[model samples]
Structures are given as structure tokens and as C-alpha cells.
Target chain A: MPVQLFGPVQVSDTVEIPERSGTAFTLEQGDTLIVIDPRGEQVADLLAFNAEDVAEIISSGRTFDYAETIYLTTGHELYSNRSRPMLGIIEDTVGRHDFLLTPCSYDTFHHFYPKLQPHRGCFGNLAAALEPYGIAPDMVPTAFNCFMNVPVDGATGKLRVLPPISKAGDHIAFRAHMDLIIGLTACSAPDSNGGTFKPIHYRIERG
Target chain B: MPVQLFGPVQVSDTVEIPERSGTAFTLEQGDTLIVIDPRGEQVADLLAFNAEDVAEIISSGRTFDYAETIYLTTGHELYSNRSRPMLGIIEDTVGRHDFLLTPCSYDTFHHFYPKLQPHRGCFGNLAAALEPYGIAPDMVPTAFNCFMNVPVDGATGKLRVLPPISKAGDHIAFRAHMDLIIGLTACSAPDSNGGTFKPIHYRIERG
Candidate 1:
């Protein structure tokens, strides 16, 4: 059963991603992808791959090196492994996001939540959603975690996952610089999503 | 021709990795691998994989999430994709190392050093060395950068690659928690090595 705690699903341009699940879709160059955290505190793990070549996937290292900042928001361009801009953030209602960690997986569950029932996490969801496009599990890289709060300790370089500050209906919008295959998930990790799961929403607007 | 600026190749247990190159070798469980910086300001990229199942590779995210700190040093354990401990740092001469950035590559050269002749960086070197072990390029993840100095800004979370503080003969030692295949490199990126490149040395000791 889909848990839709926010509101009645609007039938317009929005597409709802049920709690703890993921989906994949295509976005042509110049299109804008607006991802919404409909119920606040939910995290969306996002990934992008070149439509023409899967090898040219979004790269956190390249983006961080070039952008010079890990706190990516409006105006920040996401770079690919080939160092080409793939997506540019055009709008962000919630300014904080995380790119330092990889998508959580079954392994993550076993390691972090041994007492809870293990679930194949965002990694598994992305792999399954991307497999049809010729992407294998090993090919997946670190994701742009929307609405995820990971704070780094200045003195020790330590990191902590905290609840997101976004409110209901807060969304981030990205413009595709090139044709891309996007994998998006409503993150399954309890800590990442503030110990509760909720649906995510997104819409594509032609440029 | 290999540049030997450090000293006469001590033919004891040390294996010399010529400048800008990499090598892959096997280590049994409980074995210790000591990586040495024979020259000052040189960076070495190190990766590990479970010999029994190559799919279970070293995971920076898992390690960081579990260890809680990015400044990994002596007594820190490197975790695998499966959430199991793969390597434990038993000794560290230099306290600072980078696990935040991915291995630099040809794509890196094209992006950052477009003015100079583009050389495939550590990523390519690791790919070539690990290919024999059935590890593909995409299979590679962020490496434990030995002696590579990357400082993240506390205020903005920006990252900068700086010259290593490690002087000659500085080394870090890791004990294998499982039988493993290791890919190690003397990094080729100019900025990573402080505008120059040098050989890296390592030795294996049975537990």
C-alpha cells in the first residue's frame, strides 16, 4: 500500500514516488526536473547518466572539485565523470543537500540497522530502475541527496546525519545540460529520512 | 625510464611502483600492507577488494558512515560495500589522508589541466592494473588517498587539493581483514603531487 501522508495526489504535472521506492525517467537537454519533498523531511537520492553514453555519469568528485563547494544549491552545476556539466540547479527551496555519501543499500541496513528488518535500500532501487538502461549495480556512484542533512564537524572532519529542515512542498529544480537518464528515490535509510518514510513528487517542465 | 630519486631500490621486501604507475597484488587475511612515500609530497591511491567476491569492494561511504570521521588514521577500519571490515589502519605516520575524492583520471586531466598534455591520471592507472583481476573501470570507487592532502572548508564545505605534508620514508600500514586484491598507485595528477610526480613503495608482511 502506498503511504501518501502529505495530501491528495494532484493530477497535474506532479508524479508521486511512494515511500521508500524509486523510479527512472528521461530528460532531454533544456528540460527542467523539479523534485519535491511533498511531506517534508524525506530524502530523494538522485543520479544522472548521459543519455548517449552511460559511462559519462554524474560525478561528485568532479562537481566538488570544480564547484569548490559541497553545499550545492541554485546556480551550482553538476558535472559528469567526463567533466561536462550535466545538470544545473535553477531553483532550490531547501538549500541543504548531501553529495558526500553513496546511496544506502542492503549492506547499509546490515551495518547500521541490525536490529531492524533489513531492506534493499536506495542503491537497490536505483539499480533495479536503471538496469533496463544498461546500467549495472557496480556502475552506480554517489548520489545527490536532496533534502538530506549531513553536517560535517569542522574541528575533526566528522559527519552526522540529521533531519532535514525542509517543509512540506519544498522542491528543488534542475535544468538538464544534456540529454540524461535520471534515477530518483525517496530514500529508505531511516536516519537519512529522519526515522520516517514519506512520498516524493516531481514534475518535468519543458524549457 | 623509471626515475629513482629516493634511494637505491632497497631489494628487501619493498616493491617499487615507478612514478605515475600502479600495480595490483593479493593479500591473505590478517596480512599487513605497508605503503611508503619514498619521496616528499607524493600521493598514493590505494584500493582493496574482497578476493572471494570482487563485488564486495571498499566503500568510502560505508567507512565514513561507520567510522564517523573523514580523517581516517591509525586504528580506523576500512569497510566494504557489504558493511564488513576489509582493512584496519594499524599504523599511520601522517595523520591526514583523503577519502573524500575519487581517483583522478584522463577525464580529470582534461577538466583541470586542459593547457597541458592530457595524461590518464590515477584512475586510468588503477583501471589498467586492476583489469587483470577482472575489475572494470566502473567498478572502481573512491580510493584511500595515502598522503594526499585535501582540506574541506568548515564554513562552505569547499575542497582544495594541497601538497602532501608527508616527508620521505613516511608510511601508513593496514592489516587485511579478509583475503583481498589491492590496487595501488603513485598518483599522476600534478596538483595532487604538488606539481611533480614520484615513485611510491610498499612491502607486505605476513601476519
Candidate 2:
């Protein structure tokens, strides 16, 4: 597919390689890219490399690495053990994004909180987005949360699901590994953690 | 009225007063109450006085002392002054809340954000909620955004509309001043802001 712009951006902003939420697609050489979480409360998982260099991101190319961290935030540098800044968080409005915590999914919910029944209710965000890709529900790992909140308890020193830090129009932009493939899943769990789910607009463009 | 508990607290939590969202009522003396923004992405305005200690809360019943300041982040303390913790930013999912944006109503569409007319819309959130109680459309003021994002420009130091900082179920709770009376409204607008409006639930209880 033509490298397209996905999320919303300013009127004059250039178009960049675009990808849907929770769906990963590779970028081409010489491709400029951006991902705007138009709604400040949204989050995104991004990775990049030279495409020719395996040392850049990874060979397996999983969408998310882990949740010990989540959304890209200022000070968090995207790099390899090589200690090079692949992409440093450029902008953040909601403070430190939830980099740790899995994206919300139905199968996971059935196993974790709100343990729902078989095939009923609103399909969790990631699961629904992955349906077209045929990604098995069983393969769902702990994807890092982008805008999702996961707080650390002072007394327990354990992580807990906190509220999202971004809102309807906040965004994070960065350079890319050989054209990076982007995947996202707009959350549908409208009533999960305290029923604060509010849908936001998405836009990806070239800066 | 008796006090009630709103959250999914311990199962044993009891209440003489029933707590529910989208209702209207007045506060009485000696009533310590909690007001929760179930959907963290809202700004609620509080107008209150000394239900009991008016002389103290209102600067010794000064000529004027309307509740002011923004609210957000769970565990934040809301004080009458810079000291006393009158209301704890208890149970906040989003970090900060706005205190100046007002709720939209059915009539609000016709008045503001009028480009997309011809479609169904409400005037204002609080106005609709207070219609049964004689609160009119013109009386609304800026609300405190619990999870909505409003950023002060780093360069100009001007307040600009940012994306939402909240998701579906994140919430923030505050204490009532007197027998508090409030009007509430949720989202319906699709063209305004980043358009992440979702349904939300509210709760009230006695502390």
C-alpha cells in the first residue's frame, strides 16, 4: 500500500507512511513518517531501524516489547544495546505515558480483570483490531500500554493500572527504522478501569 | 439525606443514603460528601459555601470566595486555602483536571460549534441536567477538567486546548463544600476537539 498518513495532523503537515491501529505494515526506504494520537488520551507502539540492520529494532519484530514501560514519553530514548538514539520521545502532554502494561484485549480480560464470558460484549480493542490480521488470540502478550495508565504503589512497589496520561489530541513522533510498520488498537473497553474510555482521533503524517 | 458510597469499594461498605449518577439534589448541614468524576475527561465547576464553617471556608464569609483552581491527579488535596486539605484529589486516574470549560447542551450546538448544525445536539451538559431544577443555559461557567488536557504553551505561556488526558473509567473524587448542588453533562459532540467522547457513569456518597 502507498505509504499513507494515518492519524490527524496540522493542515500543512506533510503526509507520511500510515498504519492502522493494531495492524503492522512495513515502511519503504526514503519514507518519512509520523503518528499523531490526536486525542491526548491515546497511546501508540512505535519501532524503527535501517531495515537493513537487524541490530536496529529486532528480527522477530513483535509489535510491543514489554509494559515495564508503555507510551513514548520525554526522556525515554528508543535505542538498542548499541546505545544509539533510534527515536527519543519528542512530545508528551499527559506526562509519562504508560509504557508498561499490555494493551487491553478480550481474551486477556477473560483471564485477568472483568473475566467476561465466551464471545459476548464489546470485543476488547486490540483483539478486534487483530482480527483481520488473523493474529491468534492465544498469542497476545503483555504489549506495553501507550496512553493507558499503570501506576506504581509506593508501599507495595508493585505496578497497578493507573488512568491514561494522554487525552484526545496528544501525540508522539519519531524517526524510523527502515520504513517501520505500525499497529494500533483503539480501545473499545469503554467501561474498563473506572469507565474513563473516551475515543480519540488518530493521524499520521510526515514532519 | 444519609451518606452513600459510590465506588466498588469493599463489599461490606454500607450506606444509609443511596448514591447514583445523573440525579439532582441539595446539600444539608454537617454533610461531608464526595463528588466523583467517573469519566476523568471532564471539568466540573463547584460553587459552594460554609455548609457549617462558612466563615472559615469562605475567608470568614468574606465578600466573595467562589471555589477556584483546577483539579486532577488522584490523591491531590483540594484546600480552601493553600493548606487545609478540604477535598483530596482522591481516586484520580488522569493527572490533571480542567476547571474552566463548560459542558455542552442540546442548545449549545445551536449557539456554539454551530457549523455542524442540522444534526441533533444538546445545548450544554450541566444545563440539561439542571433543567428540571431551574438551571438555565446561560448560567453555565468553565468546568474543571478531570482528565481533559489543556496545556500552557512552553513558549508563550498561554493556555491552549490539548487532547484528553483520560480514558473510559478513570475518575477523581472531591469533597463537597455545603449541601452541594450540581448539574452534570457528558459528551455527544463529534466534530469538536479530538472527538473521543464516550459514555460515563457517576457516583456520590457520604464520607
Candidate 3:
């Protein structure tokens, strides 16, 4: 079992994103959002938008450009397309994540997993969950994939999706820089989750 | 003067995209779109969308994932969000290109070039040019930056944007797999164009 560190002082609520599903909620500034992979090797896709304006969505390019590294972990800030900070990684146990890939969609299923039943992947899940917040599908940008182990070959710049190294109970936490609308998911892509579907747990904590 | 090779057999009208501006046009299947940097070191941001459905836009993630390399060039196919091939590179004089970075925007200037006059940048330029086609700004995805030189550090995966090495008259040609709406720009970001801006020229041809 993985040990949880730097977690919330008081337990408010833990929301379970069932296997292959997603949810959306609001997190106020200074509050920490803890996303937990209850079972080992599960990947969670995360997105954030400014509460004041949905047009200001999280930008992977801005984050990668400012951070100066693709390996984003503690102390890194996620920036919006408008160049404003949205979230900061306050604490993290599993450091490996993916900001290079877009959320998988129904087309992803059709292209990669034709042998399996067609299903709306994480993109669709995020779109549906965020719909209530007036965020459209096209508005969804590249996601901050927590615990997704995608390795890019240095010499060739080739990418490979590998099983996540995050063990059971491992988690990553972020503190909001502004009032934000967040869409998160227990990823549905088989390749991303090491061929197993699992639940993701998260909670919002306030001081 | 750079030698143009494997160009269209017959002559066609060449459209000049003024410095710091953009334009949109439709290319039918099997037709080729050739984008040229009239005076080199200029970066032209390019975007493609399925003419049938605007929602099925070009996807850098899918293209990179399928091509297995971030350095996309000759013979590579650019894929859409739905995993369909949108265009294929038939010729490229300057092999270096960028698919990882989002189009530079007003916010990008605000963040990086605060002292410089605030320009809409390529993102805004593309949005404006594509608006008549019903493509909202939010629908724009990461652009395929032609002639842009962005090298990623092998050990750290850090990205650095350097001035394009393309010389005068350097160009790239892409054959459309499906009818596509193309948005091309003479990049507005100073850093991207090596502290100066120049015109981008393009012409569509049917064999």
C-alpha cells in the first residue's frame, strides 16, 4: 500500500469517479484538490478552466513552456491559454504524468480498439460532465493526465504508452490559484490504464 | 534562392498572406496545398479540419501518436481527432516543424513579449480567418508550425523555440486525403519569427 502524505487536515468529502467515468466540480482559490488512484496503474485525466470565463482553459503549451520541462510535478503551475496561472502542484506522490496527448474520444475507440465495443472515451466523458458548466466539447483542450506513463524517446521523440508506476493509494494534489471549474476522469482508454479499468478518488480540501 | 522540387506541374495563383496575418481556404481530396516562406526564418502556423464536419479537426496528439515521432515531415500523414488522415506531406525542404505548441495568442504576447506591442498573434489570426467557416476560436487546436525550429532537450524534455533555418523560397507541400479547410498564417510572435515578421505564400493545385 502506498503511503499518503501532505493530505488534507480535515476530511470534507471524497468523491469516487467510478471505473471509466468522470465528474466536474468547482474549487475555490487556495483549496487543494486531491486525486487518488485507488487501484494501481489507473490514469486520471484532469482539466481546469477559470470560473469567471470558461474561454480561459488550461493550456499544456503554456504550462510546458513556463515549466521548462515536460515532467511536471511539485511546485509547477498550470497556466491558462491567456497566460494566467490556474493551478499549482502543491504535493504529489506519483510524479509522472502526460500533458502531450489530448483526451481519448469515441474516435479513439474506433481507431485503436476496434475489436472491443465502441465507447465514448475520456474526451466524451469530460465533455458530458462539463456540459452542465456550459463548457462545450470543442473547448476541452489537452488534459493533465495524472499517473499516465507515456515515455518519449529522447533521440527520436517517439512516444510510448506504458503502464503507470503509481501503486495503489498513491495520489497527487493541486492547489487552485483561482476559482475554477474542473473536469476529471477515471480514464477509459485501455492502453493508458494498463488494460484494466479502475476507479479514481478525489476530494476538495479547504483551510 | 532555394530550389523548389516536386512542385505542381501546372502554374496556379499564389496567395500572399501578409506579415502578421492569416487566411483560410478549402482543398479538395487529392489536391495539394503548398505553403512557402517567401523570405525565410518566418514561421507559418497551419491548421486543417475536415470539410464535412468542423468538429473533426486536425489532432497533433493523434498524428504524433500514429507517426511515432514528434518530428513530422515528408511522407507522414496528419491525422484528425477521429484518427482519419487529413493530409500527407509529399515534400519538405525544411524538415523541422512543431506540432506540440499551441498557436501564439494575444495572451502569449502578454506573457512573453510584454514590452512589445500586443498583437493578436497566430491564434487570433487563424480564428478570425476561420470564423467565416463557422469555426469558433475555441475550436482551434494545436497548429502544425511549418518551418519552425523547436528542439527538445533529450535529457530533460525541455523545449526551446529557435529561429527557423528555412531559407528564402523554402516550402512544404501536403496532399489532402479528405476535403479540408486550411488556415495558414504568417506567425505574429516575435520570438517565433526570429524577432521579425515576413509574409507566407501558399497556392493550391490539382494534378
TM-score of 2: 0.35
Candidate 3, B1-207: lDDT as tens digits: 233566554335888999999999899898989999999999999999889889888888778767867888999999987678999999999988988888888877887888988989899999999999999887777799999888877556777889999999999999999989999999998888899989999987875
Cα deviation of B86, candidate 1, in Å? 2.5
Q: Which candidate gets the maximum lDDT versus the true structure?
A: 1
TM-score of each: 0.88, 0.35, 0.87
Candidate 3 global TM-score: 0.87
Q: Model 3, DockQ value?
A: 0.45
| lDDT (Cα, 0-100) at A40 in candidate 2 | 49
Q: What share of the true interface contacts does candidate 2 keep?
A: 0.00
Instruction: Report the first chain's TM-score for all candidates.
Output: 0.94, 0.57, 0.94
* lDDT tens per residue, model 1, A41-107: 9999999999998988887767886787778999999998766899999999999999878888988
iRMSD per prediction, in order: 2.1, 24.0, 2.2
Q: Fraction of the real A/B interface contacts present in each candidate?
A: 0.49, 0.00, 0.40
lDDT of 2 by residue, B1-207 (tens): 323366323212222111112334444432333443344443333333333332222110011011212223454443331123344445555565543233333433454456765323223334455555555443332333345454432222234445566654555555554444544434454432355444444555544
